[model samples]
Target chain A: MKITILGCYAATPRSFTNPTSQVLEIKNHLFLIDCGEGTQVQLRRNKIKFSKIKHIFISHLHGDHFYGLVGLVSTFRLLNRENELHIYGPKGIKEIITLQLKLANSWTNFPLIFHELTSKQPELLFEDSKLSVSTLPLKHRVYTNGFLFKEKAGDRKLLIDKAEEYNIDFSLFKSLKKGKDVVSEDGKLIPNRLVTADPPPPKSYAFCSDTVFDLELVPMIKNTTVLYHESTFLEDQRELAFPTKHSTAKEAATIAKEAGVEKLILGHYSTRYENIELFRTEASDIFQNIILADDGEEITVE
Target chain B: MKITILGCYAATPRSFTNPTSQVLEIKNHLFLIDCGEGTQVQLRRNKIKFSKIKHIFISHLHGDHFYGLVGLVSTFRLLNRENELHIYGPKGIKEIITLQLKLANSWTNFPLIFHELTSKQPELLFEDSKLSVSTLPLKHRVYTNGFLFKEKAGDRKLLIDKAEEYNIDFSLFKSLKKGKDVVSEDGKLIPNRLVTADPPPPKSYAFCSDTVFDLELVPMIKNTTVLYHESTFLEDQRELAFPTKHSTAKEAATIAKEAGVEKLILGHYSTRYENIELFRTEASDIFQNIILADDGEEITVE
Candidate 1:
């Protein structure tokens, strides 16, 4: 899985920085998160294929989080996109988009579906053959939810040397790969454990942003391969963090350490700070595996 | 009066050029016309003061014409604009903008007023002591209107030599400049015209775009100081102009000639042509005073 950060700054789009938006590439799916103003331009600058974005997730109703939704949708229609686009966001999202279309007297020829989330608890929002997604309830000024994407474990690998030595029937390979005991042609019972290797480990990615420090999510995102958390302020602005419902770099590291995530990615830095090295320095105090999510940066997880 | 062209391309926002959008400065009022995508960036690149723009006018519902409206509004809000903003456009514009705010749940802190125009006839949309704006009905695929901005004839210019001879009271000079006859202390009636010359002929600017060669507007925009009209095609593609309700360079020049405008500015050229000089070449055939509008070009109308 690979995740590309299109934008990471908060508040507004500037020449050097952009607002919140990212692309998480899992298998063949490109999931877009939090499209702020200038996202389409950023997408173009990043050389990302616009058509590949089939799913978009909005954290809240803040302008910085989803101001680009309407323009992107309109551009898609102009480009003659026929594939269905799925949008998951707060309840008011559909009304917002429909109203724009109504006023412009333009509607998308493609099927545009909205998955409005009103629940305050964690729940599975989407699941397929290879991956599953669940919402992570977050505390913010408005109704918000982060997303956790987990990859499903694959079938056990075959122990080629052991299986061949045991004269395992070729036709029974499927059952043996499932770690099931199979009987050979001579009616001899063959143990699946000795013929099969361990299955590949599943990977998970969790996204949390525009939220206050909330440790309750430790259990929900435990052992995630990568955790991208918002760090809008530094420890010096800790007082401002709680009231604004944003996290400091140290707070994000604390959450990542508590969740035992393999890697902690920090983003959504406020525009006040000109230098971002402070974030890495502060976050490293608690979590050693921490990375600053710069715009256009890509991280690959195996 | 000052007119600045932010963008004038026919289609989309590209790296080198932008779509339709311009800034008109008249009597301390900054009016924005047809906000296409990247308008904010263009404004920033041109170093135009955002706070001075209190009103925005959208010509039509085409995406290329006003796709940047929502982004500008959102950016203003982020910039903490305290002044009220007034938007004038065709019906459905308000709904689209308000719906976006509703969906994002991020309403503007400053007051926003929308004037929805549904009339096909000329109507005064805005007026102040120094200027007035009226819609010029145009023929297009969509309900579109060109804007006619007229700077109200200024106070009569003070004829210093004549005023000195008349011993005009300095305080009464105000009334005389307002074109009012004033009686002197000796009971001598002084004609306002005798003491004052005509205020430097009030400058006017008319913006006509995304419309066909409709000379029916000649009388409505006649004798205007400057006329910025769209010339989306050349004489070679005149066949494609009528069906699309667009005008060619030659056609725009013809209208300017018939209207008796001082200067004609041609813009909104299609990207098919490698060089824009051809537009001026084609237009100059019919109109002597003609210039091609380039992005970031500014003209002072006297």
Candidate 2:
């Protein structure tokens, strides 16, 4: 799995810094998350194919999070896209987008589907053969949700030498990979474990942003392969976190520690600080495995 | 008068090219015109102060022309701007912006004023002591208006030498500048014309964009100092102009020639053409004083 950070700064977009937006590539899907202002231009700069994005997940309705959505939808129409676009966002998202389209009188020729989210509970959003996605309720100034993406385990691996030593017929190889017992050519039953080994463990990633420090999220994101959490401020500005519904770097690291995530990626830094290294320095005290997200940075999950 | 081309392209914004947005600095006022996507960043790149902008004029509701308005407004709120923001656009602009703010729960601390335009005739939109703005109706796929920014004729210039020669008292200098007859110290009446000259012929700039070639604009923008007109296509692609409700370079030149404008600025060129000089070449046959607008180019009207 690969993740690209198109923008991760907080507040307004600047000449060198952008707002919050990212692309998560898992399996065969490219999911766009939290499209902020100038996101389309960021997508172009990052060289991400606009046509490949089919699903978009918005964390909230903040300008830094979802202001670019209408422009992206309009550009898709201008590009003459024919593929269906699915948008999962807050409940009022549809009205905001549709009103702009109506006023402009430029509706998309392709299917534009909107799934307005309002539930406050964890619920499955998408599931296919290889991957599944669900929502993690977040505490913020507005109604918000974080997404969890997980890869499903594949079929067991076959041991060719062991199968042949057991005199297993080649025709039963498929059945053996499916974890089933097979009758060999000699009419002797062979157990599945003897011929095949277990598949690799499934990998999962959790994305959380613009939320206050809450222990409730630890249980939902526990043991994640990678966790991306917002760290809007440092320990020096811890007093601003609760009132603004944002998290400090130490607070994010505490959540990562409690959740036991393998790697914690910190983002959504307020633009007030001149140095971003302070975030990592503060977060490392609680969680040793810390990654600071910058615009145009790409990370790979093993 | 100075005009900065923040973005002067048609259709969607690209990595290097931006959509339609510009700033006209005239008579101590910065008037933003047609805010497209990425305009706020463009403003930052141009080093223009955001606080100086008090009025924004939108030509239409097309995404490329007005998508950045909401983000700009939201940024003003984030910056804690105390000045009132006035937006002039099509009839539905208020609903579109208000809906987004409502959905995001981000109401501006400063007053947000909207002047919705629905007229097909020329109408005054703004007026001050030094300048006045009026609408120039244009033909397009949707309801559209071109803006005409005209400098109000200033108080007649007082020739200091001429006033001294006329023996006018120092206390009567203001009256002489105001073009009123003043009594000299010898009790002789001095005619205003003898002591004053016309203030540099009230420079004007007309911004016409996203519209087809319309002869009716000639009367509205007649004898303007500078004219910025949309030339979306060259003569080679002239066939696409009428159908798309856009103008060719030659057509824009024709309008400039007919309107008797001092200088013609050709912009909003379709991105399909690799060479923009071809637009100037095609237009020069009809209009000699032609300026091709590129992003970040600044023009001074004299």
lDDT of 1 by residue, B112-167 (tens): 99999889999999999999999999999889999999988888898988887887
Q: At residue B85, what lDDT does model 2 achieve?
A: 94
Candidate 1, residue A244: Cα displacement in angstroms equals 2.4
State, as a TM-score between 0 and 1, how close model 2 is to the true structure: 0.99
lDDT of 2 by residue, B163-219 (tens): 999898899989888889989999998999999999889999999998999998999
DockQ numbers for every candidate?
0.43, 0.86
- For model 2, the local distance difference test gives 0.94
lDDT of 2 by residue, A119-153 (tens): 99998888999999999999999999999999998
Question: What's the C-alpha lDDT at position A149 in model 1?
Answer: 94
Listed per candidate, the RMSD to the true structure in angstroms reads 3.1, 1.1
Model 2, which residues run further than 4 Å from truth?
Answer: none
Candidate 1 segments whose C-alpha is farther than 4 A from its true place? A159-190, A193-196, B10-17, B162-172, B179-196, B233-244, B269-282, B288-291
lDDT of each: 0.89, 0.94
TM-score of 1: 0.90
Worst 10 residues of 1 chain A by lDDT: A96-105
